[model samples]
Each structure stands twice: as C-alpha cells, then as structure tokens.
Target: MNRFRPVRTMVAAGTVLAAAGTAHSAWNSTALRTPPPDPPPVTEYVSLLMPVRNEAGRVGPALRSLLAQEHLPRAEVIVLDDQSTDDTGDVVRRLCGPYRHARVVRGTAPKPGSPGKAHACHQLASLARGSVLVFVDADVVLASHAVASSVALLRSTGLDLVSPFPRQAAEGPANRLVQPLLQWSWLTALPLRRAEASPRPALSAANGQFLVVDATALYGCGGFAAVTDEVLEDMALIRALKRAGGQGGIVDGSRIARCRMYDGWRDLREGYGKSLWTAFGSGGGAAAVCALLVWAYVVPPLAALRGSRWGAAGYVAAVTGRTLTARRTGGRCWPDALAHPVSVGLLVALTARSWLGHRRSTLTWKGRPLRGWH
Candidate 1:
C-alpha cells in the first residue's frame, strides 16, 4: 500500500492536469465565438419557442425573462402549453395575452401513444414564424444576453444548432452535493470546443433546456416531429444534426440562463435516473459512472483520509483542481464536490435505478410512461 501511494498520486495528478487543460479550451475560443459579424444586414427574424406541459409556476418567470432579453430582435414568444391538467392555461393566458409577440398555443392531445413533449414541440415548431427558432423549456430562465449570445455564435459560426448547458439552481443538502455531475460530465467526457470549432459536425452533445436552431435547417432536417419518440430528444437532435453534417456544442449557459431542475431529492433522483439512462445508456451506465466517481472523487479523498503529508497534498490538489474548474466554468457546485462519497453513492444508486428503469420499461416522466429505445 505504501509503495503504491506515489504512483496513485501521480496518476491522479495527471488526470486533474488533463481535465484542467481540456476544459481550458473554452476560454481560448471565447473571443472567436463572439465574432464581429456586423449584426446581419437586416433584423434577421427570430422566435422564442417554449414547449410546456404543467409548468405553470415556472412558465411565468421564464416568459418574463424571454421578454426582457436585450436587443434580441423582432422576436415572438410562442409557448405551446401542452394541454395541461394544471392551471397551465390560465398562467399562459395572463402572461402572454397582453404582449403582441407573446402568444400561447394550447397543445392538442398527442396521438394516443406519443410522448407529450415531442408532440408539443412539433406543434410549437409548425406554428413559429422566424428565420431562427429557439426552443427553451418553461423552467429555464434566460439571462438578458442568452438569445444574443447563441445567435451571435450561430451567425459567426453558421451552425444549424446551438445548445446551452443550463445553469442549474439548487439549495439544501442533496442539491448541493450532486449537481457537479451535470457540469463535469460534459466538460471531461466530451471534446466540446473541438466539436464547435470544426465544421465537420461529427462531434456531438446538446442541452435541450435551451437549444437554438436555424428554422430552415430544423425543417430541412425533418423538424421536431423527427424526434417525437426519442426519450432524450436533445441528444437525439444532436445526433440527427451530426448525421446531417450540422454543427453542435455547449456554451457558458450559466452566465445566460438558469433552471431549477427539480423540486428536491426525490425529483432529482428519478429525473436524473431517467436522463442518465438516456445519456449514458444501460451497459455503460453503471460501470462508467462508478469508474468516474472512483477516479475523480472517491480515490483521491481516500488518499487524504490516510492522514499522511503526501496524501494530504494529493487530495488538496484534487480539491483545487475541481474548485478551479468550477470557478471558471460557472456551471458546477464546487462545494458539492467535497461531498464525494455521499454523492458518488447516490450517483451509483441512480445509475442502478436507470438500469432497473430500462428493464422494467415504466420509466415515466412529466406524466408519460417511458419506452425502452435501446
């Protein structure tokens, strides 16, 4: 055990160094992503398309934020409130009725067996009128510059799609301890900047909470109806964009948008379980999440608990690595990374739940029962 300590420290340090370097690429390309393309010759029409189910509580604030965007355009806010049983209709009616650009289309029932959101988004897209269409979830509140930020990137880069990794708002013990996974998974696992940089469109990953698209491109590629059955429409859309040789990437969503992803631990567990299964899939789900936890969080802390100077130094570096990354990215809860063991344990539980969900085939979400795609 003593002999192996140095080797473990070196390997862990290398991992930290690697992640730090890879994540740093976003900062390098920031200026390029904000190119000065003289604000298009015309107003260049854009519409904000929001698809909601029972998000009455969240939709009001989200709509307000969308309306407040700075220099956005002659934009229209189209909220496709998917036939909710809640006060969703009244909520949209009050917020959208007064404003000319803000309008709500009450969604018709999905074809007997279709998922609610996919069908709702399809309806939203069909009704929207703009050169550029943005699909923002009702729960996500955009920062004043979010629309401009994504549009600028799209204009500068000429990509068919632009997805923002949402800024997740959380409180309480469970929320604080586990939210970093949402940020780090994309940063460490994917070569995100490289994907966005290249025009080849082979690289992929998109956050549906806030996704922007060229209207012609969206329809030319078959539209939201194309992914009406996908359990993870965001990732599915990313794949579709790639197969059609379109561009996709993540940005500093925290600066321009935020979302209370869940009410509490139970919602987080179930919601993420469903999402994790879609994102990570079954066979790789359990083992891969476990390995990441062990490597990134568990093992380093274990070395620190040994109560030796070298162990302390290694663990301190681990914490520093995570903290620095979090500080720069604005997407993760850095303090939560300190709750390594508990978070990893819960993550494993969720991973297990996801596997069980896939098998049982009753992984319901937002009032729709899930179907096993893989």
Candidate 2:
C-alpha cells in the first residue's frame, strides 16, 4: 500500500494537470468577442424579459441597463413582477414608465408543482412577441451592446440558445471564495466546443443571468414550462432544448454583463443551499462529486504540506486551472486562486446543507418553499 501511494499521487497530479489544460483550451475556444462597433442591421424582433421578486433595491440599475440597450432594430422590454413583499413592482414600474416600448406585467402565484422563477419566466415568455428572447435576471446589469452582440453571436453560430455568463461580482469573503468556482468548474470540466456540438443533455450548461434564445426553438423545447419544477432551471432549459433537437451552450459574457448574486455571507449560504442539492441530480451523485473534488483539489494541498512532491505538483495544477478560469472570466485571480481548496470545501458543505434542507422539508428560496424536492 505504501509503495502504491506514490503511483496514486502521480495519477491524481496528472488529473489536475489535465484539468488545467482543459481550462486553457476552454478559455481560448469559449470566449465571446465583442461585436463590431457598427454591425449589420438586425431584422428579428427581440424581446428582453425580466422576472423580479423582492429586488426593489437592485432591479433599478438592471432595468435601466436593459432599457438603455442599443443597436436592436426592433425590441421590447417586458418585466414580470413576481409577487414581491417589497417595492420591487413599484420600482420596476417607475423605471419602465418613460420607455414606451417597455412595460411591467403583474405575475400570479406559481402553481403547486412549479418553481417561482420558472413560473415567472413561463409567463414572460408567453407575453413575448419577439423572434428572439433574451432573459436577463434582476441582479444582472448589461452593457449597452450586450443584446446586440449576443444576438449577433446567436445568428452567426446558428445555435438555438446561448447563455452569456456574466462576470460575477463578489464582495464578502464567502463570495470571493465561491463565486469564481461557477465559471471555473464548467471551464475545467466541460469541453466547451464539444458541449455546443453534442446533443447529449449531460454535456450541457447555462446561466440564466443573461441568456439569449431563439423563440421558435424555445417554444419547441416546451420553454420554461418544461423546467417548471427545476431548481437549476437554466441548465434544465438547455438540456430540454438539446433533447428537442436544438443546440445550446454557454459563452463568456463577462465583457457584456455583470451580476452580484448575493448580498453577504448569510445570503450566499442560503442562496446556494436552496438549489445545490439538485445540482448533482441525486445525493449519491453529490457525494461522488464532492469526493472527486476533494481528491483532485483538496487532498494534494494537504499532502504537499506533508512534503509530497507529486502533491505539490497537483496543488500547483489546481491553482493554475483556477487562475486561467479567472483570467478568462474576469474574476479576481491572484490570491483567490490560491484558495481553491477552500472553495471546494465550502461547495461540499453547501451541497450537504442543500440535501439536509430537502430532507427536513426546509428548503426555500426568497421565502417560498422549493417544489419537487422529494
């Protein structure tokens, strides 16, 4: 067992190194370039849809940014107020008042089996009249060219759906440690170009923060109605699209949008806890992923502290992958990458918390009980 230990270390180090290489390749291949300052005219009518609930404090800037979008020949902005206890609806109405093309829609409570966000999105999609549907989250602020550039990429790539992952804005310690992992995990683990080309649902990924989809393909896939109960509805939507013979994948939207997902540590913990259980499909899958992450990222650092050269190499490789992902995704790179192991640990803890919440029937997001947890 002692002799085989060195071989195990070597294999583990190699896996980490391979992940680093994958991250490098994904960065080069998956980046979304800014469209030309003066691009061809877009004839397709685009509808920018947003669903807001308890976002009074943050929705203003995001809505303002959406309304300020330029270069769309024909466009409409539709915001659905999803029964917020706060002034979310009023705030959106005030911001949208001056824009004749933009309007606010009153949303009803979700059906028993539906998730709030998905239900809200389903309603917004039904109201959309555009040939293209761009869903922007209330917390996501877009650049003036965000809509135009994303539309250009969608048409140019011929993909049915494209998720431009916004640059995550992290402020607290918890945020800084875990936020970068959002992009890094997929960038290091998934083959970006292959995921786009493949029809396999398991190869798909998406971010709802700023997603662009062809309306026809979306309707064909059953739209948000197909993913009404999913906690991770963005991924579910993309998978549904692929299963329906449509192509969809993610892109580096850091240049075009930014989002701060949580207010602080407490908010971050609850936010992740609400949905992380569903991220892996099952508790067993969650355990496997946690174990794999620990072995690939956490174990090497511990062994390196014990003077193992192979372990040191693995640690370096892990950090290199994180650094590459950060550089590509506009995240904080330097000291944050060094804390990759901590991030993995926190993720595991969050996954565990998510499962526990489900078991106890305590899982909720924004004060609503999560549906379909069983």
Candidate 3:
C-alpha cells in the first residue's frame, strides 16, 4: 500500500501541483495586456506587409480588418504571395483592388538551405516605402488603431522592433486546452513590464503574428540576414534587434491585431510541429523537460487521492497555484482548465513528434518543407 501510495497520491497531486505552478506564473502575467498608456505622438511613416502562403480563407478578413482601421489610413499594405496553390493570390488581389495603397506582390522560395521567410521578407522590405516596416502574418487581423498605436510606441520609446501578443480565438475541445496552456507558458516565461523597467536589456516577448520593425535600423543591424536560418524568426529578430543596440517589447495587440492561428487542431499540431523542436533547439532534451512538466501537475493529484494526504495536498496546492496564475496572465475558459490533463498530453505527444520531425528535417508547413530543421 505504501509503495502504491505515491502513485495513487500522484493522481491527486497533479491538480494541486498545477495550481501551484499557475500561482507562480501569475506574478509575471502582464505580458498579455497592453497597458492603457499610449506612446507619445511623433511623426513616423509606417507600412504594413503580410507574407501569404495559401491563406485564402483567412486573408480576406485579415485585410478587411486592416482597411477598416482608423489609424494609418495612408499606411500602405503589401501582401507578398508565396507561390500558393490556393486562390491566395486572387484573394489578395480582389480584396485590396479598390485601395491604391494596398498591393500584392509574388514571392519565391529561398534557394535550398536558405531560410524562406527571411528571404521573402527581405524582398518585401525592399519594395516597402514606410520609414517603419511592419510584418503581420496573413492570419493576423489588425484593430482600427493597431498600426497607429504600435508606431506611436516605437517612436516614443525609440525602440527598434515591436511585436504584439495577440488575443487568439480558439474553438473546439482540443484548442481549449492546448492553446491556452501554450499562452500561459509564454506568460510565465517572460515578464515584459519588469523587463521594460530594467536597463540590462531584459524581457524578450514577441509574436511573429504581428512584428513591427524599423526599416533603417533593420538594415543597419544586418536585417533578417542576421537570422536567416532561425526557425523561431520572431524571437531571433528580437534578439538580433537587441544585439544591434535596439530595444524590443510586446504591446497590446487587442487594439492592434488578432490571430486565430489555425483552423483546427490538426492544423495547430502541424504548425507547432514545424517550429516547436526548433523553438527549444536540437537533441531531445526539450522533450524530457516537457514530459517532466506535464508529469509535475499530473502526478500530484493522483497521489493526493490515493491517501498520502500530504502529497495530494501539495499537488492540489500546485494546481491551484497554476490556476490563479493563469487567471492573472489572461483567463482561459473553465472547460479548458478541466481538460488540462488531456491538453498537456497532446502537447507532449505533438512536441515529441515535432522533435523527431526536426531531427529528420521532415517538418512541413503549408505544404512547404522546413529545410534545415535539424
């Protein structure tokens, strides 16, 4: 019974442990919100660009949202179509045909072994006319003043790069657990406000979904050329910007941008699969850490239920802590919290598969293989 006690207790402990983890995470949850403060007004030209690859359904709404924005009515929008099999090119053409500032340009894949996004963005940057260059993923939708608000921040702070933390729209059972968990993890890892308050070049939070870069500084800092091979382009870009004596931070995209990320769980899985392993880096060490994290929450609850009240209590404490932390970070619906165990499991499995795919360089996104994943 004693041997089995810990096992049983682990089950009970999982809940408590998760709670505790959430609690610790709450302290750093401000990364999700855009503080009410606005950047001082300054004269800065901005151009918005979107690089699309077979994003027909989502592109229209995304573009429409931008056209409707009250800020930067003159901000030119350029969509770089990346050889899509779908009517992505047609959609971009039709959606913005009436707007003179809105334009669509075609993009080609980089030569074998060269990174695709950096290459494409390099081309887009060349044609871009704004003093401030912005890259919004095709899936990203902008708020009426998102461009205005963001540019204001950059000008006011004199920062080199700006990225928004998006408010994701997720549906179905699978999205409920995994997406929120993923966001929570981000909230836990980076404390943006504190980073901004410090002087030692801390706090690295970004979402490629809505990345804004200063055109001149980008060139001065070696541009995307510096991070040509990085799988996590957003983070790499931010790091490069900082290394080049620039500042990077996240802003409230709620007023500036919105992203659904994927149409379904499979889409989410494949998308994350292509980049997750790379996000954590080579070897299977990332897998080990992920598994351990999931088990940390899963085990405690089981133990608590089995009779080792102490273990069970500890786990419950942990889980409660995690829950509180999540609420502070940005609340997910209650059902997602209930389904966290399964969500965590799916994430681990997906991450493991991603790592395998990365090792073999077999990961693909939107029908394009991510070259040099390993």
Candidate 4:
C-alpha cells in the first residue's frame, strides 16, 4: 500500500492543478478585453519600425498589411534589412516603393555584447521622426486598425508603452503542440489585473511582434540599448521601462494582429530552444516550472490510461483549460488541447536543450550566437 503513495500523491496534485487552471482560464476570459476602436483621423503620427533578416519569402504579407493600413498618412514605415543573405531587402524595396513615406535602410552590425535585433531596433529609432514608435516583427500581420487602436489605448490610459500580444498562428505538429502554451503561461500564471496595475519589473510582460510605445518614453528608457544583451528583448524593454518609472502593460490583441512565429518542427524547436531556459529567470526557477508542468499536465493523462478515474477527470479539466485559453487567444484547441501533456513535454525538452546549448555555446538564431542566454 505504501508503494502506491507517490502515485496517489501525484493524482491528488493533478486534480488540484486542473481545478486551478480551469478557474484561472475562466478568470482570464473574463478579464481580457479588446482595445477600443481607433478614433477617426488619428492625429498622432507613428513610425512603424521593422527589423528583418533573411525573411525573403515570408515578409511580403506583413509588408503588404503595413502598406495597406487605413490610417496610413499618419504612419511612416521604416524597414531595416539586417544584413540579410537572402532577397529580404529587395522584397521590402519593391513592396514599399509606392508608399512615399516608406523607407528601407541598411542595418549595420551590432556592437560587442549587444543582441542583433536590439541593435537593429536602436538604429531604426535613430531614423524615426514620429511621436509614437511602433516596433513590429517581420512575421506579424496587423489589422487595419492595429496601429490606430494601439495608439488610442496608450493615449487613453496614460501609459508609456503597450505591448499588444498578437494572436499566434500555429500550424504543423510541433506548433499545434507548443504555440498555444505561450499565451497560457502568462494568462493563467501572472494575474493580468495585478500585472497591469503593478510597476514591478518581475510582473511585466511584452511581445516583440507588436509593441507600441511613446517615442519619448522609449528614448527616456534608453530604447533597446537598455536591454542590449537580452535574448528576450521585448520583455526586457518593458521591465526596463517600468523600472525607469514608466507605466506599461500588455493587452489582448487577438483582434488586431496575427503572427506565425516559426515554419515547422525544426524551426519551432530551435526558436524556442534559443530562449526557454532563461525565460523563467534561473536554472532553479526553470527546474521548478518543469517539475510543476510534469506533475500538473503530464502525469494525469498517463494515470488515466491506467484506468484511474480521478486522473481522467484531471485530464478533462486540463483540456478544458486549454480550450478556454484557445477561445480567448484565437488558437486551435480541439486536438491540441487533447495533447496538452505532449505540449508540456516538448516545452520541457526544449528548455533542457536550451540550457545545455547555452552551456556548450551552441545556441544561435539567424547566424547570431545568443551570448546572454545564460
């Protein structure tokens, strides 16, 4: 009887987490709200910044979306081809030629100890002349009102910066298992209301794909230069801004922007492996999170297959939580939710690989080594 004690304990813990995750998902659904419609004829001018590298075939839709903005005259688009080996520069130049305000600039190499993306962003800021600076990733497609609404949200709330985390579009096997977990991690764990209200750096969240900030505030916090070495530059910038006494927080932008972050299994794996270990702060924190996930998400399904009724209920609750999160974030949930354990397992594996790669100096992205991944 004592030999089964650990299994019984795991079953009980799984039940508790499933209940908590379900409740947390429910709370997030109620708390997350869409940004208000953009005021007509938005007077505030915005510099839309793009940093690209080897995005030849995939960046066209994003460029098209930016050029077709309904609030165009108030927006100036700037593209920095960060020393691409492909035709990314040509794609940008050809697509943006008709827009009088659009300009493409050649990006220089990063200074020592600085991440390439952060350096590219800092260079873009030097060329921008707008009061509002919008940093957009090359893979994101913004809605017609995305810029206008983001600016309006900032103006109305009196915040210095706002990160409108776009809806993640995941396809293929790996993506279907892993992408939805991005939004779920914060939505269920961070308590959005508190994060929004708190100015603490640890509570802040930001997505690089669609970050909107007041130009003055960004410069005030030293722009991306403040987080030059950070692998997660987006979230680091938010933290730096908050520590600099500027108020900023995340908002639900599922209605305004969509991003397909990686192409397939290999891309997705390395994409995550480049930063997952550092995401939770330290080795200890990463270990704790991984253990928790294994217990909360992975174990129940295994026990269920072994004919444990309570474990089956826990699996149902976990799936319900994922479904609720997907409903809110505009992701696929049906089959993916059923594979929640698989997703968590993949995340754990990626995180372990990330730490190992960092130790071995093998972690890289777009030909740049992630030196600060430790």
**Model 1 lDDT per residue over 142-241, tens place:** 8777787778777767777878677677777777667765665565555666776454433567788998888877887677788887767777766766
Better structure of 1 and 2 per TM-score: 2
Per-model TM-score versus the true fold: 0.85, 0.94, 0.85, 0.95
Residue 144 in candidate 3, Cα distance off native in Å: 1.0
Query: lDDT of each model, Cα atoms only?
Result: 0.70, 0.86, 0.69, 0.86
Query: Candidate 2, residue 252: CA error in Å?
Result: 1.3
For model 3, residues 36-144, the per-residue Cα lDDT tens digits are 3344433566788888888888788888877665546447888889878999999989998998888889997776754478777777888888899988887777776
Model 4 per-residue lDDT tens digits across residues 237-306: 9888877788877788898899999999999988888888679889999999899888888888889999
Estimate candidate 1's alpha-carbon lDDT, on a 0 to 1 scale. 0.70
Could you tell which candidate, 3 or 4, scores higher by lDDT?
4
**Is candidate 2 or 3 superior in TM-score?**
2
Which stretches of model 3 miss by more than 4 angstroms? 1-20, 30-42, 113-115, 194-203, 308-331
Sort by TM-score, top down from the best? 4, 2, 3, 1
Candidate 2 Cα RMSD after full superposition onto the native fold (Å): 2.1
Give per-residue CA lDDT, model 2, range 93-119, as digits (tens): 999999999999999998664459988
109: Cα error in model 3, Å:
2.0
